[model samples]
Target: MLLEIAIGDAYGAGFEFCGREKIMRSNTLESYVPHELGIQAGCYTDDTQMSIAVAEVLLANSDYSSDAFADAYVRCYKRDQRQGYAKGLQGLLDLCVNGADLRQRISPESRRNGAAMRSVPLGLIADKNVLAQAASEQAMVTHNTAEGILSSHVVALMSHALLYDKAKLVELPDFILEITGFILRGDWAAEVECDALQTLHAVNTALQANRCMSTLLLDCVNFGGDVDSVAAIAMGLASLTPEYVVDIPASLVNGLEAGKFGSSYLRKLDVALAGRYPVLSAHLVRQS
Candidate 1:
């Protein structure tokens, strides 16, 4: 899931906010493109970095808490400050001393897509009820809004459905309605930047699809604003869509940055996460 998040983030990194007209002209998905951060071809942005933070917290034997999530996010952000975090958040990351300070300082209730973007790790928990509580806790660490929490819940639950019971995904609009008591209406326009509702709709649409990772990712970028995040959040769960690398382009994986927290790290995290859970549908995945 983390690996797929990085791939999708990196895949859409090149075209973030370029809008529909500019991205369509490229007409190709064969290789990594230049990222807005001016990083190397396949180096991911804050999406994968913060996701690694969430994964590490889950990897820990200690209990999950907002302090822990905040600390992990701060550590990851400090490790790579120039990785294209949002301007408003970049300032917050600098002043806050630790996790405790972050929670207090992040007073402005943001409904941005960050909550949903880093939420891929929450789906690893098999129990749906427990997962929902944890998802709210993690999202409230920064994005403490009704919309923010709801979007996180939707992505985590949908990811769980994709992994455990894909058929339940068809019931997403209903499941969200049933669980959150929130009605999901249609008529969402594209160009989804940091908006929680729009991104949730996009992730749900991507998960509702059983498309190959290649097509899923390309289609995500075509959705326009904040394309990288939509792709990252969608691909993290859908990465386990049973297609594996056979359906995924080799270049997307091989071409990822080989830094300390790059593709190799993501692969190890996936292996460790799967070891801690029952991956019923992924028995055929390539270990290598």
Candidate 2:
């Protein structure tokens, strides 16, 4: 789970964040960039940033508290202007700023990508039940819509399983199906106003290669809408089965700038994980 978060953070910072300049680039150029630059340079989007927010909340409480989670979110949004925050998240922050009932204010009205992006952190910090609660509360605060909450909730619960439940990763499809089945059975599935289904469908198909990172990139990008969220989920899946993640490409791992955006903090995380589990560092070193 920790390793997954680190990779998600790296991808978020490397690819998603840097791609902002691409809006002005030619369509042809835009198409060529990802393949040329690779996913390593692909920074994370609102997804990883929100995950960071969740992690901050967990660190403070060592558990999931809806109130504390909401507070941390507001703080993260305000602190990181470059968090790739969108309007939906901004609204949640607004409600938080106004001291609104976060649980009630955030409802099924939001069918946006906000929920799925940040939910991964909760997945890592808590168990499935707590993860589901955190995802639901966070979603309800701004995205009252059923799809919105499901998007985040399903992914968060899956992430939790991936990180803590070793048995789950071995049967990836069953795990994804478990979450999807819950979403399908939930009230959120009744309100099908958004393209979230498309994203979920894509995710379902992509999980077939549930053991391969390259397969995730293909499925995530090619599967169409909500590539960032799709990729984020894929990252969660891949993190669950790191044995299949392969080594980080030399080019992507080499030119990383480690002095910015608490890059050192990320390294510290890496060191901690490595020290506690020498095999991880050994794997990384071998990959290097």
Candidate 2: segments with Cα more than 4 A from true spot: 1-43, 88-108, 168-170, 176-180, 183-195, 255-259, 267-288
Candidate 1 lDDT for residue 70:
90
Per-candidate TM-scores read: 0.90, 0.67
lDDT of candidate 2 over 44-77, digit per residue (tens): 3456556666666655555454566666666765
Model 1 TM: 0.90
Candidate 2 vs. true structure, TM-score = 0.67
**Which 10-residue span in candidate 2 carries the lowest summed lDDT?**
185-194
* lDDT (tens digit, per residue) of candidate 1 on 108-158: 489898888988778777889888888888888888999888888887776
Give RMSD to native, each candidate.
2.5, 6.7
How high is the CA lDDT of each candidate model?
A: 0.76, 0.51
